[model samples]
Target chain A: MTSKSSRREFLTRSVQGVALTATGGLVWSYLLQQQAHAAPHAIRPPGAYDEAGFNAKCIKCGQCVRDCPYDTLKLAPTGEMVAIGTPYFIPREIPCYMCEDIPCVKACPTGALDHSLEKIEESRMGLAVIDIENCLSWIGLRCEICHRVCPILDKAITIEHHPRKLSKHARFVPLVHSDACTGCGVCEKACPTEIAAIRVVQPELVQGKIGEHYRLGWKIDTPITQEFKAPKRKDGKDTPATGLDYLNQGEI
Target chain B: MAVDNNTVKPDTVKLGPNGKPVRPFVMPSTLVGKLKVWRYIIYRRIVQLGSLLLFLGTVHWGWSIAGEPLLIGNLSSSTLFGIVPLADPFAVLQIFLTQHLLEQEVVIGAGIVLLIYTLLGGRVWCSWACPINMVSDLASWLRRKLSIKDSFILSRNIRYVVLALSLILSVITGIAAFEWVSPISMLHRELIFGIGMGWMAILGIFIFDLLVLRDGWCGHLCPLGAFYGVVGKVAPIRILFDTPTCTHCSECVRVCPEPKVLNFKKAAEVGMIASGDCTNCGRCITVCPENTLAFGLRVQSNISKKSSNKLESNLRRAT
Candidate 1:
């Protein structure tokens, strides 16, 4: 071993080490940044925390993947896409069966899958959105496999009356209500089209906020607010509001 | 025995062409000698491969004891018998440094691992359990066979710098920095659960260790190993050094992956391998022709076997 190095040699070695470390750090940090932000569509196991929290807390152990009875979960491999080594499921191939016990979440050592999610109905892995134009029910067919297979049943997916162009009988279309939908993706898997008419996606992708101001007062649940009420005329007779005329009658 | 180097006995092994004793990794001529030589290695393989099999069996084969699954998850975190949790302390520390609220199971798991490793000599995980060891071990073996020498020098202390950087990055990135990109996890997680491009990272480490340097990844760059080395400072299990009987054969040095841990002068004065960096792999113990090295309790200051025996019995006594 060298007892000592000259000042020039020592400086050169120091610079080399620093340069190597800096280069490695730059590349590594870029990788972490990309990996963290990528894979937005990944449907996590039941009772998963929000995307950010799940990514932060999930130890990437794949325990949940192993525990899933239906083989619904898979740990994202090093390079494919979803947060590497974190569990995710492609609903089209094999959607979550919505097991009553939720073995996948139960197997998670870290609370990446929240323990508080005692009931399967409480899980919100993603939202089920329908392609209105391409759906068989919308195209005037009797197909409602998605509605039939949904574990939440009528509450999650309800067959509503749709007026058809020519047919005397009304068309029954499957309408997914977010209030009861657990996003289990059974509908996505059960759809018989070459491409699924209904698909599961992160709720933020399609869900829009009505904001705080717009309240529909026509519904029975909506409180009678004075903002939309008719004003009294000089003769003591009320003049009906003009816009959105159907809601003006106030008879319910 | 106080055997002189000049007068090697007929029963004893001869020195190499360069006058150094044979490395322990080399197969011996006699059948009994060959079997004895690979004792530690065989046991390590059994442990490493057996644990992996248990995890795989529980998952794919429905292996269970009394209807409870045995061993779930990889080295980063795991559960045994569907009850006791075991997690990598280094990973838990990284995530903890990120300031995220970790669950109690992972915390308890980390504590359990930390306690077990602390008493067993911490790098027991590296040599005995870490799947990466097999890759690096193969690389080092191939390096010897191919007569490949290190292209550059790297300080073994570099891993501590990396450990510090990982923690700092965890705080900055709001995630476990090392856990995100660890080749160790890539290899272990992918192999057991399913396929992935993780094999590419494994291949990279293998090539780097084989061609760039001897024991490059594990010895010089693995922050996990460095963390365990620090934890091993207070470990009770240690390699006992009997300096008087030593022939200065240097076989232990050649065989050991971490050769500096066997600094003879320091080990002689201390009466044991005192370096925290020592992995306690027992290569030195198996290789020493004079039986100069051994696996024993961390002795106080006994240079002789008789006094060390007395100390061991005294410590072992119930009273």
Candidate 2:
């Protein structure tokens, strides 16, 4: 009778312990969720997947941080409230050198940094936006520092000729093309302005999303006449007015 | 009797209140005896310290110790010699939870780690490699010294629940939930990169063990250790009890961090410590005055012969 009672007691205790532990875990996860949502998104190393995919895949090992030659990457410190132990870089302090071999991506054991990005230029780490109001080039100065320092050279940042009424020479406007830009932050790092005239921003934050329903008809290279046959009017009306007829009708 | 008279000095034996000889906490006098006792401990300490130093050397000092530039990495995941891949199984499990596909290299790496732990005993990582073990050990020692009697007992099976919850949480949250708050990873980061608020978590664990519970974090709550315990269930290396030489002092129980593994009554009947929770830490062997405990293979044929040999020797000493 004593043995049976003791066994029952043990079972109760085991159940209670399990309940307590589960509660602790759920509370911890709740705290983590709150912090994670509150924390701002950080710029991950080159070849990092989109935010959700990267968070799911990254093991937070700090391998990429160790592999970065220029010390461009750092494991998210505890206070940052970003995903703990995951690697991120502060561009103003140290910008990615955009090494041809892409050592950081190679070092990732898990495919957190997509291994498919073979070329350095292929990485869309972030996009650089030039603040024209603060830019010396916009203020009647010949500062083409961002264009010169860009790793992609003329492909990423091109100097557009802006005719200045006050100055004799044309103002060189550094236009950043999203396609060629890897957001290496070399231009931001090299900017001579007191506050940087150009800065690297997360592509998701800055890049505008196009409406899913919108489609460009002109994107197709083939002639429209070859691709589509003119439909007969369902109302048995005259054939649809041509472009020239519509223009003449408005005039008349 | 002749050997006993020559070796057993009255002065060397310190008596407790009950007139039994106090258990020796120090190393054995003879070199071979000391080696048998301290070998596992020394190896474990060296491994734990070496692993920490390698990480610190690479991340902080930027020393190219591994020859190849930027080849090796932190403890959680790394490549040895720039070719052989290695990853922590828990880390891989988190990735598998969300991604639902394990990379070829990650699978190979986890497999290598699993195979090694299977041979060496899975919780050997807890004893030998985990940095958090050192902290818990310190807490245990302090508790023993201070004679802190108040202990909040929680079920050891709680760790399994915690383990399951952590994996589930990882899947739900899309983050390595446990690793985010893990003091082990936090301590590693603190050592390489300076500490911020993470040190509080380590301190909380230490205080929890010291004041609130005994061996609470690693024994009861750590999902990582719980996972490893499951892996090490059938580990061949175990503590063999020669019941003939056992004086029944229960000193091994007193010293053992996991006292349930030593099960003196069961060990006397079975002639071996068969508990999967046994870390093969060799602590029981170190504290046993009779020296009945030794690291041995748990094979059926060898047990009877070994016990008979030990009995004969013990009988001679008794006479």
Candidate 3:
């Protein structure tokens, strides 16, 4: 009788363990997929508690809504009364300008907006992520404006060296420096593509979670110089090449 | 000599022709003389004492605002009479809890005070001296100037929706959203000197009163008014009518801003007249020229039965 009962318990435990393992595996896979697709995006700068904080300590007073330079923010409606006066920016119509000196941060009296950021790069508005599939350069075309206009330039925006195979013309494409990118979204603004090949979403870890490790990564992750070698033309006289040549040029 | 007409009833009473002093009249019936309605009026006065204190306390708070913050909730003593630079206290509470002081004791205390008073007096806050009611009264006065037609909207149940929303949002966001509906806060900010158009909005309503609708916004849209309506449901004191003396001239109904009180005339019995909308403003009593109405008390939970025709006649003969 003892052996029979023990066998039944063992069978129950095996079934339960198998079910748990399958569920865990599915959850792990889903998380992995999400992480793979997710890239850092822009975030509202931290207020009061962090640098570039809005001081109003803000009581969520609606004063900021009336005073916003861009009128990008409004009262969140009675239903959203909790969020009341906190401002949120919509990137499609009005994105954060990454002003060399933050103006809104200074306007806040209660420390809802923080005015302490000295460098534009140090201000984490959010991070910019490139959709390689949608990016013009990744399509073997000639768009590198994002890398060029990036405020930190070589520090924040860098190029990857990839050799293309077709004709006797220019070669290589520009890759992004993700770590240096503050996701100020200026590049998304500068993108010549009509539909805007790049866009921004709020990044996880929010703003102000950066510690010594993040700062260290910012310093060491400077782009490798060789990757930025200019695309060479057959004539090689520093002549700007055509968009077509940029596509097939065995670019490096 | 008109002996039957002139003889005063032992149990019944008569107000002098002027409607102020009372004279005892001969008992018209056995039933109402036994009820002894005058005792109930005295009871109402007892309740009114507490109501009067609440009104004075609210005003006294205004006097203290020089040192205190404009809004309610936990605040630091160093915050200048518990006043912070921020006009509202939700932000202060947020800052406090983050610092681990858990200063929520003060806010909870204020909530208890409001709850106890509401259960007792039934929106006595509105009838006596809620700043919002004061503003509504001002708006009603303006309604006479504008001659706005159809000003009072029948929205008795709307306040429950508002209170529920306020509680739900407060729970969800951990911030006090009800400050917007606080009449004292609005009055202090808008009527007294303050920066910005928040004041303008309140004043603008008066200006709007000039164009169309009498106290249109306050009568229809004031969430605070709605809250008072809901809280007054269980009020123990009410304005009971001696219906036979009610000449059916509709003067009381026409004068009553609260439609529920007017609807009470149609009710079966003039027992406890406490509905959610009773403000205990005494406006009905003030306007009743016939001396047919008086404030009365009842058992805490009794639903009054319709007064009999004979009882109504007794009330008329007594008055």
Candidate 4:
């Protein structure tokens, strides 16, 4: 009788313990969900996946932070609220040096930072945007610093000539190309301005979202009309006579 | 103080049969006695604090030796002297869940760690390396000192349930959900980044263990510890009980953090401790007054059979 009562008590306690632990986990998950917004402008390490995918995949192991030779990468602190241990870098403080081997990507245990990114040029960490009004080059001061320090050289950033308002002297406008820029932030780090005129912005924050229904006709290499037309006859005719005729001729 | 009616001699000493004065509960009198009692605890603390200092020295202080960094890595995964790879199995599990591909180097590192734990009794990590253990140990000590009673008790199986839940959550959310709030990871970050909101997690666990439940976090709810417990179930090294020497004093039971693992009655019958929960912390061995408890190979059947043979021989001689 004692053993039976003890067994019943054990079962009751076990259920209570399990329920309590589950409740604790649920509470923590809910709290995390409440403060899920990460800093929008914090630049992730090179080869980091899109924001949602990155958050979903990164285990926050700090391997990337350790492998980074320049100390550019750091695990996001607890204050970040979302994906706290995930890696991010403040570009103005310490920019990526664009190492040849991409050690950080190699060190990543999870493919959160995609290991398939072979060359540093393939990295799309963030995009550099030039605040033209604040730029020294736009004020006709001959400061082409951002363009000169770009890892991709002329491809990533180019100095375009603009005539000064009152003089024939040309103002060098530093243009940043989204396609060529790796967003290593070397230019932002080297900026001589009190506050950097060129700053790295997270890709999701700067990149525009295209409408789902919108299709670019230029993307198709073949003529658009050929897609709707029936195939030519087996006799090697240039075009099918008609849809029914083409079907009848065994050339649908 | 009330004076007793019986007159007491000033130099009268009360001694046990072993010719030593009766000692207070769990308190060693001399420095040597304390050292003997706490040697394992001291060794574990040295290992835990040493590893933390080594990593911090390399990362935070930028301390290098002989033209090479002492150790250049963090807690989750690291390379010792740019050669040996040590990866946490929990982190590896998270990687597998998220990426579904195991990189060769990561697999190798995880294998190395897994093998070491399997051989050394997996809870070795808990008692020797895990930073949270140090905090929880302090809380346990404080709780004992204060004679704080447990307000709540959690079933040991809750840790296994937590382990399963974490894996399920990872799969459902496609994220390493546990890492976001894991006290182990948080404590490591706190060490490097200076304390932020992460201190709340460490403090919460300490307070929970101290005030609400005794040894709640590691003993009840930590999935990492549960995983290690499974790996360590068949560990070769364990505490052996010499039945002949045992006085049944139960002092070892009182000192043992996991008192259930001591099972003196069963140990007398079986000759060796055989519990997955046994952390091989050597506290029982230290506290055993009869010196019956010692670390030994888990050849329980053979040892028991030999003892039985000795009993038969003694009976035959008496006849």
**Which candidate number would show the highest DockQ if scored against the true structure?**
1
Q: All candidates' lDDT scores?
A: 0.84, 0.77, 0.47, 0.76
Off by over 4 Å in 2: A1-22, A35-40, A165-170, A212-252, B1-40, B59-66, B69-71, B300-319
Report the C-alpha displacement of residue A40, candidate 4, in angstroms: 5.1
TM-score of 4: 0.81
Best by TM-score: 1
Model 4, span A75-124: residue lDDT tens: 77776643577788888999998999999998776577888899999898
Q: Categorize the docking of model 3.
A: incorrect
Q: Which ten residues in a row have the lowest lDDT in candidate 2 chain B?
A: B1-10
How displaced is residue A118 in candidate 2, in Å? 0.8
How many residue pairs clash in all the candidates, one count each? Answer: 0, 0, 38, 0
Instruction: Kindly report the docking quality category of candidate 1.
Output: medium
lDDT of 2 by residue, B1-319 (tens): 1222112235555543224464545666899988877677777789889888876776677556447533256556776656778888887887788754555777788778888887777787888888888899899889999988756657777788888888888888877777767788788776776667787888999999999888889878898988888887776666788766665566677767777777655676667777667777777787777777887776751665466567657767776
Error of 4 at A242 (Å): 13
The predicted structure with the larger lDDT, 2 or 4, is 2
Indicate the TM-score of model 1. 0.86
Model 3, residue B112: distance off in Å is 3.7
Q: Report residue A32 deviation for candidate 1 (angstroms).
A: 1.0
Candidate 1 Cα deviation (angstroms), residue A183: 1.2
Candidates sorted by DockQ, best first: 1, 2, 4, 3
Candidate 3 positional error at B232, Å: 1.1
Q: Give lDDT tens digits, candidate 2, residues A58-147.
A: 776777787788989988767775667778887778999999999898878788899898998899889999888999987769889999
Q: Check candidate 4 and list the clashing pairs.
A: none
TM for candidate 2 is: 0.82
